[model samples]
Target: MTAFHTDDPQPKPFRVADRLREAREAAGQQQKALAALLAWDPAKLSKTESGTRTAITEADVRAWADATGMSDEDRDETLEILAHFKVNEKSWRDRMRHGRRSVQLQYNELYRKSVRFRIFQTVWVPGILQTPGYARQVFTDLNELDPDTPRDVEADIRTRMARRDHLYDSNKSFEVILTEAVIRTLLVEPPTMLAQLVRLEDLLDLPNVRLGIIPQGRRVRTAPQSSFVMYDDLAIVEGFVIDNPYQGAQAERFAALMERFWADAVEGPEARQLLRQAITDLPK
Candidate 1:
């Protein structure tokens, strides 16, 4: 593993813990005294400050701020530090309350801001490359399985279609890797799937895009559990309940591993041939 360098070398666990200890000491409150005032076990406070806790909630930080007599300005800053721990993981159900279109719009913003993107998928077509017809079916199928998926499937599809324009932006570059199984999966009818495959071929002609396909029945070294997108330094992974973003070392490690996964795949004309073959296999 290469050493991933950042301007700051300290890990997140230590950063959060040290900040809490500093806040308490600066407020002239002992651990036990603060714990008593907050009605929390001393051990819980110890674990949090010692960086032993598995997870820390936003409420925990707010309560600590109040107990420490943190000023309004200091409280806001403390909460911002707390946000580092949870900013990466956002619940899809929570995001979809307004509707899936809102989530798609968020993606559009992310897409527009990123200069480079590394996308890997084990199932379904890549979102930015999907045709409107195919994107609608993909959203519809996801809605069937996830009751929380918003009802605005058509509007969501339109938003997704708008995202495709980014593929032509010369200032940006996209490297996409897909397992052969993605081609084998039938999310829509044969005709729609065929159109998507054709779209993939058209996208290949774009100067900024590089797409690769890992052949079926071929032994490969890399095993990816889920689809993820690495936009610059951040790795956005799809979780069962939420989207998990990794930062610093964690993001660097995944980004390196994805490069290895991309290497095991076929690209250029061979990848195009695989797509054509998959299209041919579809029902007439």
Candidate 2:
């Protein structure tokens, strides 16, 4: 495991550092004095002010506020800012209540802006790569889960197909890992599934796209967790009821997930062979 990275300017500027420094200065305390109060190295405080120490925890933030004599309101506001740097979670149930199209739009924007994507799926093809027939089946199944929710399955399919536009951008890259279980699962009709497999085979040949399959029975770094999407430095982990975005140490954990993906996955000709075999196995 590596230490948290604070030197990168990604995810935007470290506003927490600036806020802490301003709070300390407003309290009329020097960095050395604040460090002494918090029993931390003066360099720790200085580096944090300079945006090179972003791994500070909530407890550290609270301690700094309390030690610096910040007003309660100011401290709470600071903590709120720090919370964003940590993680943001939303219940999938609530998200779906507004209809699946909204969720699709959210990802549409995310896909539009991202330059690189690291995706892992344990039981289904990743959405962006799904064929129209396959994606329609998926949306239909989702609608079945909650018939009361308003759904325009056709519109949803169009949005999903639009997301695939990013796949052809030479400046963009994608690395996807799918478990063997996902390949064998028959979610759609045999013809639709076979077509989806054909799409995967073509995607595998793209210079900027890499597809890997973790064959069954292979040892891996960790048990498969829920499928998730890693967009640049941000990681969006899908849970049973919620989708969680992890940053800081939590986001760094995706590195381990990536390792698990590559360690057990077969790529290049091996992946192509597996996909072709799957297509052949589809019902006649």
Top TM-score prediction, candidate number: 1
Q: Each prediction's Cα lDDT score?
A: 0.78, 0.79
lDDT of 1 by residue, 99-169 (tens): 77776776788888888899998887878989888888888777776675558887888889898888888
Superposition error at 136 for model 2 (Å): 1.1
Question: lDDT tens digits, residues 1-284, model 2?
Answer: 11223321123225788888888988899888889989999898888888766576789888988988878898888788777655421233355566778778877887888888899888879999999999998888877855766888988999889999899999889999999888789999999998899899999878999899998876787788689888877787753323556776887899678876798899999999999888888888
Evaluated with lDDT, which candidate comes out highest? 2
- What is the C-alpha local distance difference test score of candidate 1? 0.78
Query: Residue 245: error of model 1 in Å?
Result: 0.9
Off by over 4 Å in 2: 1-98, 239-241
**Compared to the true structure, candidate 2 yields what TM-score?**
0.66
Question: What TM-score does each of the candidates earn?
Answer: 0.67, 0.66
